[model samples]
Target: PRSEVGDLIVIFRAGAYGASASPQSFLGHPPPIELTIDGDEIL
Candidate 1:
């Protein structure tokens, strides 16, 4: 498989118990966490 390299967007609630939509990217691969607020992605 081609090595997945590049940016990614992860969505979840501000709460600690919210499950991440992109768990594979957020919890796996050691990706950096970027927060999204009010349907807007953090630049």
Candidate 2:
């Protein structure tokens, strides 16, 4: 398990509801862009 080139991997699952019950336009898929970081300021 080794990664390079921008390395930022996090896959710890227990019921990870990524994309919030994703059904993106009922499968047409195109609606998942909501980020709001405060520390480094990306809001």
Candidate 3:
């Protein structure tokens, strides 16, 4: 995958730990969306 080294990628389940540990703000990334569920709603 060397040809795709700089392409955008999605790292599944990174939020479990990476989000908290990664210096996203310092890296200039916006805050990640948080999800919450209650009954039949997703907030």
Candidate 4:
């Protein structure tokens, strides 16, 4: 699938471990924001 700017993409099975494994902070890139959803409700 293709993602455009401002698109909300969901990745399963990613948590603290995934963050530790990624290089998101490399080159000064900000870390990803985490969101929780429950049955159509965004928490």
Candidate topping lDDT = 4
**Which numbered prediction scores highest in TM-score against the true structure?**
4
Model 2: residue 11 alpha-carbon error in angstroms? 19
Candidate 2 residue-wise lDDT at 42: 81
Kindly list the per-residue Cα lDDT of model 1 for residues 1-43, writing each as its tens digit: 4446674545455565444444555546764555546645553
Q: lDDT by residue for model 3 over 1-43, one digit each (tens)?
A: 5547556544556556645576678668786654444567985
Q: Report how far residue 9 has shifted in candidate 4, in Å.
A: 1.1
Q: What TM-score does each of the candidates earn?
A: 0.26, 0.24, 0.29, 0.49
Tens digit of lDDT per residue, candidate 4, span 1-43?
A: 8899999888776666655567777789888777766789997
Clashing residue pairs in candidate 2 (N, C-alpha, C atoms within 3 angstroms): none
- Residue-level lDDT tens digits of model 2 in 1-43: 8899876654335254656566677577787554545578986
Winner on TM-score (1 vs 3): 3
RMSD of each: 7.2, 11.7, 6.4, 3.2
- C-alpha lDDT of residue 13 in model 1: 51
* CA lDDT of every candidate: 0.53, 0.60, 0.59, 0.74
Clashes of each: 0, 0, 0, 0
